[model samples]
Target: MGTAERINSSQRTLPYVEIMDSTLRDGEQTNGVSFLPHEKLMVARMLLHDVNVDRIEVASARVSEGEKEAVRMICRYADQIGKLDRVEVLGFVDGHLSVDWITDCGGKVINLLAKGSLKHCTHQLQKTPENHIADIKETVEYATSKGLSVNLYLEDWSNGMKDSPEYVYQLMDELSSVSTIKRFMLPDTLGVMNPLQVIEYFRKMIKRYPDIHFDFHAHNDYDLAVSNSLAAVLSGAKGLHVTVNGLGERCGNAPMASVQAILKDQFHAKTGIVEDQLNGISRLVEGYSGIAVAPNQPIVGENVFTQVAGVHADGDTKDKLYYNELIPERFGRKREYALGKNSGKANIAKNLEELGLELTPEQTKRVTQRITELGDKKEIVTQEDLPYIVSDVLKHDAPEDKVKLISYVVSTAYGLKPGANIKVEINGQQYDGSAVGDGQYDAFVKALRYIYKKYLNRTFPILANYQVSIPPGGRTDALVQTVITWHYNDGLLRTRGLDADQTEAAIKATFKMLNIVESNL
Candidate 1:
């Protein structure tokens, strides 16, 4: 089907999505990484303002002096801006320590963690249900007196509700009637339940406490976090908890991107999710946290919406038969076609559409076979390198190889600046350039840009992105591949180059960029 005829069948009127960003709180708990005081404040502001997450859990109160200082700065900013209600902190059940810390930090809301499972209550706390109930009551009462809103977390409510229903019901009964309790946040602490269990447990709670607001939090131990979250919502959950890119402890929390998409598409649920900002926000979190987002991650992963099989690409051409509700555009991405062992003429055609080129059926078949052979050798073939593959397959010089790099010399030493001298021919015209820069690659690009702007009188494309990759195996002389993306007035242009040396790989790709620009001109 034509792009003009595409329909957004995923969206219908649904309950508003309540986004709770945990990037500062649970996200910081990621091993070996901690955002400094100002970093937490910066992320908090961005989460609330740019991404428009409804709520943010800034930090845990009383964790450490650094944590306290971080929350203090965040709350100071949040309070002056009247976002006190939206900024929350996780606090323990310790009597005055948590409450005092939160108040001092200018935090208004506290998610008080309490034991729900029988094992934790009996083993960890070594207290009976009645005694624990009294402790919670005192803590809630104290927090209320301090003008802090209280939310109780039945730490492992699912397990408690299943194994010790009597104790769980009695505690909920008392807390539901408490004058200071604003909400009851239920957590499947160990992530033991399925969707059916979530439905059963949530129904019981809603029936028992008809007036209380309940927020359901999920974990992905069973990989059913998304399904169970939906089940909770269907059974009358007032709100749900989500972390951007699923940044949490073991197995990660439910990914906000997937939860938001599934809810809006299948369940017809509405959320305040800025559908377009999902990728950028995920990238920012990945960069700040130093965690590599897996390529197969549900919503924001690189390959989630890509079609790798040739049959799928062919089916996509015929009214988009291969598509489901998760269209890439919905989450600020585009569908991509992969060309490798599984590719056919259809996949090649789809990629050709993007590069503004077409080929005869015979030529496309030949190119597909060549890609498959390369894939069999474990070589990744990207669309940026498709022209070179086609040139090898059809012997046509790729239509954009008018510029070629003749040779280059670059040197880097321990205590000295990096420098480079490069020679290239553009449109059969030779240009020699040299420069010293932050690094050899930087020097090379600067010299090339000088030649383009000063002598050729042309506007150089900005390097939007540059990435280098080598195969997983350890080989000192392994081939390095460099991909460069150039941004100009019309749009972006990408090119790839491969060589045994890293610097040569980058230089080869730069030469391809020059040729692409010349061809366009």
Candidate 2:
């Protein structure tokens, strides 16, 4: 058929998009990432109840003791709500191990992995394709007799389509003709298939067995997981396999957010996914899995929606020329303008809008220059530092240098209390105090609090966060940076202090806080 004919045929099948999420199983298999039992249960509920995934493969049978418990807990919760059939487990060709595991765990569906390619059947299993098919057939028969559904997985089917199409075709033909197999999972085991190939091969399969349900599974070896998944959907594949945050073996699986977004926006395909909860769910998965998502990762990434270029921010002000169909707000996030070397006046204006600040052209230019200089020195500029950038660049005579720490001393001996002495001047009024704290910086903050509370009779700002960063090749005293967050009536403000000593870093941040607070007077 031609492209239009395919499109017409696809549109007719658009109402039947299927999404099977294996984040709990395949995603948890990410090396060095393990989800706790409760986390496993939580992610399972989110994938089914919140994201509305059609089915979730919670775990692989015979993995480990913890995995068994995790699967058991998830099964119990799923079975409690009458949605037990929506959960599945990965089972092997070893007949009873998987069957009994599923029966004991209260699982209803088993995705049985069997040889699809001739190479796997002959080389890996050391058996002929027909004999291998017999084994899978018997396994399915046994499971069916036990009142369980079987989904057959043709592992490495992508390569089978290329090198051994006949073997793949024969296997599909056999399984399709079998009543025990409920679904056929076609996996690009190595993530080697391109969009055109996915379209072509999927067409071949659907034409041969239009009645058989095929679920397309993709990997990200070439970073084409989402594209291939979309192609599968467009080519009339009934189900698509995905993982949360694209977490899986090798490069990962197609991220559920990307697939859902593309389907809903481009193809007008509808999924039961609650689009708004994408961020929260992604974060929960990340925290439990201990996988750090890169900042530029699409959809659920931290910086995906942030505009870092000045021109983009400028366009955003005019008509949103920089905007794309991937709006962050649609996925429970807000757009932000990054402050950096590339951030021009427009970027500055965007930050000012958030901080409720308006500066003249000259002031804006000065602030922008200082930010660029900081960027040149390889500094990360966060929105919290904008006010200080403005104050430093504008340099409106320094405002009397109201807060000055004339002298401070901290000593950490072999076995002695960590004490700090600080002498600070606020508006030419100086106060000196000494205090001991749990740590050196804590001692300093305690003394400062004494001066601010007893002497000034004012409420000190609340510290919301504390972050410290060293250069790439870390050194204990090599210009350590301490960023402190303080909240006042206006809002929260972040101030950073860098120095060779950690205590000095805290002192610098304290000075910035004093200035920020005194500026209002």
Candidate closest to the true structure, highest lDDT: 2
- Residue-level error in angstroms, candidate 1, position 5: 30
> What TM-score does structure 2 among the candidates reach?
0.80
Candidate 2 segments exceeding 4 Å error? 1-13, 396-468, 471-521
Q: What is the C-alpha RMSD of each candidate to the true structure, in Å?
A: 5.2, 5.6
TM-score for all predictions? 0.86, 0.80
The per-prediction tally of clashing pairs is: 2, 0
Q: What digit string (tens of lDDT, one per residue) describes model 1 on residues 55-91?
A: 8888888788999999999888887877878899998
Residue-wise C-alpha lDDT for candidate 2, range 221-299, written one tens digit per residue: 9999999998988877888999989999989999988899988887778788888788878888888887877888778
Candidate 2 positional error at 380, Å: 2.1
Residue runs of model 1 more than 4 Å from their true location after superposition: 1-14, 37-42, 76-82, 398-466, 472-477, 485-492
**Least accurate stretch of 10 residues (summed lDDT) in model 1?**
4-13
